[model samples]
Target chain A: MTAYSATVTVRLKEGVLDPEAETTQRALERLGFELDSLSSADQFEIELDADSEERARERVTEMTERLLANPTLHDYEVSLQQR
Target chain B: MTAYSATVTVRLKEGVLDPEAETTQRALERLGFELDSLSSADQFEIELDADSEERARERVTEMTERLLANPTLHDYEVSLQQR
Candidate 1:
């Protein structure tokens, strides 16, 4: 089996209530930083031993879609690389 | 000023006790996933308008070091892109 690394980014889609993002934006403004818009996001990095890079990508994608991300409110993307 | 987007990933440094990572590793093992090691991590994406990309990077790095991450147990990396 090949060793693989995958990074998954999960974020609330546009127009979602992101209190953390809101708070950060306000805080930045207070610090005199200008921002047009802000959104809150999270990421996960998983290391896996799989048959191939393709297999690792497929599995990570399935995991994100099925468990790690909320489809209705969150969008996710997975990137897999051979290690 | 340039509009910029920054992503900061915070993770427990090596040798640190990471309960979340431990739990995830066990869960993956239960599901028959082959993982050599697992690390718990979190990501934050910040959008900022600053005088330049350099300024945004500097500010975000400061935020991560000062408030967003625990220096003793956590390490963070920041990436900035012009928007």
Candidate 2:
């Protein structure tokens, strides 16, 4: 098995209300930073041992589907690097 | 001014405790997914008008320093794309 690092980024589906982003934008404006809009996302990095790159991707994808992201509200992408 | 999109990724500094990631790792293990370790981060995407790419990056960097991340515990990177 080879060590692999996977990054899963979870984003709110477009049209979903993102209160955290809105609150952050408000805070930035208060600090005199100008921005039209802001959106926030969560990314998780995992280190694991897998047979190949495809296996690493598959495992991480399943992890997102099962625990890292909510399919109903989140859209997630997984990327892997051999380590 | 040009429309710009900035992505800022904030990660915990080395040795910082990340309870969220630990909980996620445990949950994944419970579901039969094996991993050596896991870490979580926050990413912010900002849409704004800026005079140049440098300006856009600067504004978002300030945003991270001021509101998006706690400097004592987190490190952040800012990247910009013209939109």
Candidate 3:
């Protein structure tokens, strides 16, 4: 098996209410920065062993579907690199 | 001022214990994936009005310093783009 690095970024689907992002947006505005909208996401980096870059991405995708992301509220993207 | 977009990524500093990452790592392992380390971060995207990209970046950096990131436990990166 070859070593690989993977990134999984999970974000709330458009239209979902993101309270934390809203809070931060308010705080930023309060601090006098003019902004339109703010959104937040979770990013995860994983180092692992996989046979190829495609396989690594597939594994990470499965992991995201199974554990890292909430299917109902989140949409995720995975990137992989051979190490 | 023109429209701009900024991305702020906040991550735990090296040596800080991230319980959530640890928990996810363990779950991945339990599912039979062999891995080295796992880390997680929060990414924020903001839309705003700025005179220039540099000015937008400056504002986001200030936001990171003041609230987006906890300096003692986190490190953050900011990216800005003109819209």
Candidate 4:
């Protein structure tokens, strides 16, 4: 089996209410960082032991869509790296 | 300038208290997933427009360390992808 790592990122879609993001943006502005917009985000680093890269990618994608993310209000992307 | 996207994942080190992870694990178990361990996690998808890939990577890494993550209690890895 090959060892692979998957990074999955989930972020709120535009037009979504994200109090956390708003507060963070305000804090950044106070810290003197110029910013346009901020979005609430989350990510996962999942280690997978699978037969091949293709299999790992497929399984991780399935996991992200099925369990790791909420499809309604969140969008996610998955990237696989061999270890 | 090159357009790049960064994905940063922050997770608590092992032995840290993760109430959110625990609750999520329990819910997953109820949904019939066999999980051995669960870790609290978060991620950011940052878009960067920089002069070079190296510059973008450096800036993103700095941002992750200085602002995006709390290094004492969390560890993060940043990956850059061309956009």
User: Which candidate leads the pack in lDDT?
Assistant: 2
Q: DockQ, in order, for the candidates?
A: 0.55, 0.91, 0.88, 0.29
lDDT of 1 at B16: 85
lDDT digits (tens) for residues B1-83 of candidate 1: 77888888888888889787678667766776666766657777777779877888888888777666889989888988887
Cα distance off (Å), candidate 2, residue A82? 0.8
Q: List candidate 3 stretches off by more than 4 Å.
A: none
Q: Who is ahead in DockQ, 1 or 4?
A: 1
TM-score of each: 0.85, 0.97, 0.96, 0.68
The DockQ of predicted model 3 stands at 0.88
User: What are the clashing pairs of model 1?
Assistant: none
Which candidate number would show the highest DockQ if scored against the true structure?
A: 2
Better of 1 and 2 by TM-score: 2
Cα lDDT over the full model 3: 0.90
Candidate 3 per-residue lDDT over residues B1-83, each given as its tens digit: 89998889999999999999999899989998778989999999999888888888888888889889999999999988877
Every candidate's CA RMSD: 2.2, 0.9, 1.1, 3.9
Among all windows of 10 consecutive residues in model 2 chain A, the one with the lowest summed lDDT is A19-28
lDDT of 2 by residue, A1-83 (tens): 99999999999999999987888889888888888889999999899999999999999999999988999999999999998
* iRMSD for every model: 2.4, 0.8, 0.8, 3.5
Order of candidate numbers by DockQ, starting with the best: 2, 3, 1, 4
TM-score of chain A of each: 0.90, 0.97, 0.94, 0.86
What candidate 2 gets wrong by more than 4 Å, as runs, is: none
Error of 2 at A71 (Å): 0.3
